[model samples]
Target: MNAPPAGLEIRPLTIPRTIDDPDAADFIAMTHVRNLVYAETSGHDDGRMAPAELLPNYAPDPAEIRYSWLVLLDGEPVGRVGVDVPQEAGSRVVFWLVELRRSVWGRGVGTAAYALVESTARAHGRTVLQTWAEHPPSPGDRLEPPTGFGSIPLDHIARFLQHRGHQLEQVERISALDLRDGLPRVRELCARATEAAVGYRAVQWRLPTPPEFVDGYAWMKSRMNTDAPAAGLEFDEEVWDAARVARADAKIVDAGRTALVTAAQHTETGELVAFNELVINNDLTEATSQYDTLVLSSHRGHKLGMLVKCVGLLAWLDIAPESPRVLTYNAEENRPMLDINEAIGFEPIGYEGAWKKVLSDPTTAGADTADSSDSSGS
Candidate 1:
């Protein structure tokens, strides 16, 4: 830790955090500050992702590797920021986590943490120093455009990103289909899609996704970058392998969340061409359906995307009838999938534009499996 230029000094935080340290006071106090500042400044509660009490092991054990430090100004713990470089992130770059404290909000505390975050990532032999901030969308890329979302509109940490030069990339819409309506017609459309692909066909496979197929599924996910737009994302495709695949499976098993999927696979080669995964929230708050649609250059003609979804919908309905709705996000430009979702009755719940900022400098940008694993949380 270098002495932060003159009036400010930044160094590693020495707050003890462990799952067993139930009396984690600094951890708890910091959570309140973070959540308050986050919600007040950003408009949504940030603490919902992980409670302050969870400072120790926000994630499960095997994946249980986390190192963070608190920032202080002249001795008062102003804010805290840390790095979470997962050894692996479901085939993605083990992520980089950077969080800040409130009182230190405008004091160059963030700039200081920014410096520390990069140093930390480099120390771990990681090349990327990624962090997510709610800045406005960048100038180009029709897929993404400016939407008035600053870190927290009324307030704005995201402004820091734009000022810094991060660019906006992908925006996700939360959509839902009232499954209470039954899917006789949706299934029929799926069956029709299956029938239409003469040489190509839709194959429905269930979990116990076969040890051999895990890598394939991870591969399919990594392809989100293909047509899927993201900001500052440098996709590393090699991260997904058999061992990592099994670790993912083991994580799910250990967490006890059931995986139900219906994906479109190549009939001749059995290569997984397109897919969707559905999760049943054990807490029963609501079931989640994550659908990622893809097509190989050779397999582009068939309605495999739609077919897989309909089949997956039926499967989810059958398995988790207790589910109230099915939800997903589609870029507004993606009319084709939108057409299918509409045909099956999924409608927009809310819209949010994904924003990125390179600032003058760029920071590319969670945890846990205690039962619930929302993408934002990790």
Candidate 2:
């Protein structure tokens, strides 16, 4: 870090009244800062897809209080911080995200910004505040990514969090599937999966989930939380129903994104037994993100996960022919999902470390120890 710049400042930003509202001045400035920092650390520029631009897709729950801040140096934005207060009563955890330009990383900008964030959390009567940081692979770790793109160095954020009392909670593998390379293999696997998935068939729709399967889809969505492999992270079984599914579909549509869903239905009972989602932002030329892929335990033996994913990918190729890649993250310990991804030629690219710090009670809460942050960003 260079010599500390003078007069560092943290300014609050207002959330837009509606997604269509013109970008607020502060929000635009923060997005620029985030883009610069992201390019510096990740070696890629995604200015077009900055957080401010994607806010509508993830609008907070009605009862959740959200805050955004700009970290400025000499009156210029250099970093960003975002926080969300839990909406439910008896919940003490507050979720947050932070980023600082690499040039100003060690000069206390992140620390000062986090101080303000902590103050805000405490002011909300929240007891725990947690954020995530990605770490670069160690020297001994395998490297398969082509030159230039590689793991983000873990040292900087690791040291920063440890200095502030955060501890490692879980690690997830960032994996990618090269559509062009896997197209043939995907078809082969899909064929096998179809044969193995006898007595079951798939249903799919673009954005809004079909009305008839909303309830079954909701049930599977809730089961996704409880049935997956979650090793060390604290998580809660999410409450899902038709209403939440409808809202989620609306959010996806509002964001100008298309969701290609391929779900396996139990032909015998007409229930959605397994499902997977592939989301493509308006920019069909870039990589698509793969969201939740779940199969009820009772429906697990039929290879439905692979069947649904392959079908979804095939549909994506037809709809977004220009797409180059698909990205998905799975807990490092989730061998089953990883196995399916690997079978489909999804290669390892990087890793993300989930960190947590529990705040001690103010009357005695240390505000440093981490014990209450949920690992899955709940």
On lDDT, the candidate that comes out on top is 2
Candidate 2 per-residue lDDT, tens place, 144-181, comes to 22222223343656656666676566667878888775
Candidate 2 residue runs with Cα over 4 Å from true position: 1-5, 18-23, 45-53, 58-60, 137-154, 362-378
lDDT of 2 at 347: 94
Question: In order, what is each prediction's RMSD in angstroms?
Answer: 8.4, 5.4
lDDT value for candidate 1?
0.54
- Give the TM-scores of the predictions, in the order they appear: 0.64, 0.85
lDDT of each: 0.54, 0.71
TM-score of candidate 1 relative to the true fold: 0.64
Q: Locate the minimum summed-lDDT window of 10 residues in model 2.
A: 369-378
List runs of model 1 lying over 4 Å from the truth: 1-115, 122-157, 200-208, 230-232, 289-291, 332-335, 351-378
Q: Please give me the total number of clashing residue pairs in predicted model 2.
A: 10
